[model samples]
Target: MGLAKVSSFLLVILFLINGGSSTTFTIVNQCNYTVWPGLLSGAGTAPLPTTGFQLSSSESRLISIPAAWSGRIWGRTLCNQNETTGRFTCVTGDCASSQIECSGAGAIPPATLAEFTLNGAENLDFYDVSLVDGYNLPMTIVPNGGANGVGKCNTAGCAADLNGVCPEQLKVTVEAAGTTGVACKSACEAFGTPEFCCSGAFGTPDTCKPSEYAVFFKNACPTAYSYAYDDGTSTFTCSGADYVITFCPSVSSI
Candidate 1:
């Protein structure tokens, strides 16, 4: 196609050359089920969805295209469904197909990897592919065993995996992967412990915003700290392995 400009929601700087570079996009799966093909996003006056790529468990696949692509990419992991059967689903059982169906017999029905943003113009970044079973599922990206990524926005946010750390990349992955090295729940509620920590004994529930915690992480350690999450069922605690012993407002954020 012609010059494919990066979307505005993301931060990128595109350079045009005689023959653009050919970079392979990789998708990794650390979750249970397989993910569908894949989709790409663009703004040729509107956002258009592209086809997807299929990957198996712990599988990695790459896609190479001529046009410069960045920003939000879309797609789903569907089963091998039957189109001729009125309402066809890509999958039903274990049988696998791009958008086809199987005979109620197969390995395992594929799951969906929600749409994620892929911007190459910023610091090089890749997505940590994790198949999800449903909508309410928690993230398998951060503090989990998966890949790392960066936001296309200026808003502050860090990513980690089940490994409890973020990629050491310059851009997408940054210096704030684990601010205090001791990371805690953004919302105790998100961790199903908000009422207790933000509102429980010894703790002042819901009194601290993530930005506040961020300030503490930056000021308390400023350099870097050890990160750990103490998840006790209905109670959650995130702190620096060697630092967090008290809660105080970071003078900066304040």
Candidate 2:
């Protein structure tokens, strides 16, 4: 056989061994209203094909993610474009890009985030639905077609709508027709104290213990990362899997 033919054969073998060297993510909008999904690639990782887009209720989009990609995905709600200025903005999870695409910008907290680090240590994909940033909407991450890693490849997220039950002080309200809560703010974002933010003297896990606010989130969403150091039950790992991210996921579905 020719040298080129041999090289091609080896490449095919590697592709099969590495599970095609890419992952597919299906982003679904299960909410009763519209949602704009924003994506931000992690530092040193290439951006995906899209940074942001709108998804009407029951709609879904598929994105191909390169191997070793790391990023966070979240949903933006109550978006509008000003006709006079042509500026786009959202009430929650806005990336502040003035356009549909985030263009390398991240969601301005308090936004729930679905975080991922694909093909990481030991070739495992680490993922979690983090409320540590705060909570704008119910979200979940479900892994498909992956070998079980040290951590279980189970569904992870907060499926409950926290806005209605959010503390008055941490509630993000909008006055469309009347005052209505749209999102819940984390204690760190609401107060900005070292004890809550996990900064300064409380930077370490040992020093920074869960507060009453953190406990509130944890009690509502046991599988999510409620605070900065809520890792024990928050993180999950898988090997070579496509992911399905759903916004406003039903509690029973999760």
Q: Which candidate is the best by lDDT?
A: 2
| Candidate 1, residue 250: how far the Cα is off, in Å | 33
Report the number of backbone clashes for model 1. Answer: 36
Q: Would you list the clashing residue pairs of candidate 2? A: none
What TM-score would candidate 2 get against the native? 0.95
lDDT of 1 by residue, 53-116 (tens): 4555566554553333433221233344455765434321222333332222222312212222
- Kindly list the per-residue Cα lDDT of model 2 for residues 1-254, writing each as its tens digit: 99999999999998977756799999999999999999999999977999999999999999999889999999999999999999999999999999999999999999999999998998889999999989999999999888754557889999999998999889999888256789899999999899999999999999999999899999999889999999999999998789999998889966
* lDDT (0 to 1) per candidate: 0.28, 0.93
Instruction: Give the poorly placed runs of model 1, Cα more than 4 Å off.
Output: 1-19, 45-50, 65-67, 71-78, 86-254
Compare the candidates by TM-score and give the number of the best one: 2
Q: Give one clash count per candidate, in the order shown.
A: 36, 0
Could you tell me how far off, in angstroms, the CA of residue 4 lies in candidate 1 after the best superposition? Answer: 30
